[model samples]
Target: MFEVEVKYRVPNHDAIRDRLKALNAKFLEHTEETDIYLNSPLRDFAKTDEALRVRVYGDGTVVLTYKGPRIGNVGKTREELSVTANDLDSLLEILRRLDFREVAKVVKRRDIYNYENFTIYLDTVEDLGSFVEVETMVNDKELINRATDEVLQFGDKLGLKREWIEKRTYLELVLERGNERR
Candidate 1:
């Protein structure tokens, strides 16, 4: 499951949401993902300078991802892990008790999934203004290239990143932009 993706700066969420609705897409609940980066002594974790995070995506969509996992290292993989959600309260209650380690910033991101096999996420960081992400999984180089092209086409359609093909994870860009905003 190689993940090929791109992102752009969105003018506004409402504008994008309208387009998504026109495409028969729905806005999923906003997910507050919390990442806890750690220090490792060996293996890939030690060689790189990134953070380890335990992400909680709305309700019970819990996952543990590196704050800065090497770019493209886990790109082509079914790398996401989400938890079962009966209701959001139980999950929120659990999070309230745990003392989560803080990082440089906390990001509030809205997830919009296209029934057409793509997911668009709108992120609003503590400092960063606004950004959007389009992610799709592909296998083989040709398909990956095609997917990249497709994403680029949509980006153009949306008037985003028309020339800049960005592949950084949402976290990295948001963090950098957020830091700059301050």
Candidate 2:
């Protein structure tokens, strides 16, 4: 599937949560996520704008995801393939044996909400402060552009300003912060 989303840096989630309540958005579960990012030995995923991740949720569920390079200039649109993993240690061992090296670990608490056709994610990232992500998934590649527009429009409807929109991924932000500190 293609994941079409836009992320915004916000001071806090209070305003967005109120707006979501006003819109009668359905509240989903709140969960903490630990994402482990890996790098391929053969290529530089950072240069290619691709990602491989192992996500362990607070409920003990584990997921393996491969995200392709970003497709368009409008939004953070990409082809995402994901599957559930039964064993996190075994999966990490397999990836390590295959020469995939761990690059970064990101932890965040996420509150999910559903309004209309969009899944809204309110995230409080470790060390990175708060963010809101508006996202939708589409199976057809042709629908990506339209989906991107809709995601942005939905964010605007929720009082998210375009100026606050952030195109960088959490991992990128973390890496940049590390570089700045060094």
Candidate 3:
């Protein structure tokens, strides 16, 4: 499946949550997430624009996700594959033994909501500021264009301006900030 998403760096998160509430969006869950990104032994993920990470959710569920290179220009469209893992430590140990090195750890508190076809996230990361993401899953590759359009329109309805759109992931932003401190 593919994860088509659009993200924005917003100044006010409470306002967005109020908007979602006004729209009668279904409140999903509010949880904290920690994502540990790992680097591949064969190639540079930073240059390839790919990511592999293990996300540990607040409720103790762990997920392993692989995000392929993004497609198109309007939104972040990518081939995403994820699976739930029974043992987080074992999985991490396996990756480590395979020579995958830890790159960065991203910690965030997220409020998730669902409206129509979109799943929205209001996140506050540890080093990065507030962000809002609207995403949907599609099984067919041909549906990505239509899905991207709908995501952009949905974001617009939520008062997200074009200038507020952000392309960098939380991990990228955190790593960049660390670099600038040097």
Regions of model 3 farther than 4 Å from truth:
none
User: Cα lDDT of all candidates, in order?
Assistant: 0.56, 0.95, 0.93
| Best of the candidates, TM-score | 2
Could you give the candidate ranking by TM-score, starting with the highest? 2, 3, 1
Pick by TM-score: 2 or 3, better one: 2
Write out the backbone clash pairs for model 2.
Answer: none
How do all the candidates rank in terms of lDDT, highest first? 2, 3, 1
Residue-level lDDT of model 3, residues 1-182, one tens digit each, is 98999999999698888889999999999999999999999999999999999999998999999999988887789898899998999999999999999999999999999999899999998878899999998999999999999999999889999799998877789899989999
Model 2 lowest lDDT segment of ten: 71-80
lDDT of 2 at 99: 100
Indicate the residue-level lDDT of 14 in model 1.
72
Put down candidate 1 lDDT per residue, 1-182, tens digits, no spaces. Answer: 45666766665667766677777776666666644333343333435545555555655565555433333432322233334445445544454456333343355656656646677777664555577777787656457667767766775665565544444544566557767879
Highest lDDT: give the candidate number: 2
TM-score of 1: 0.64
- TM-score result, candidate 2: 0.98
- Residue 135's lDDT within candidate 3 is 97
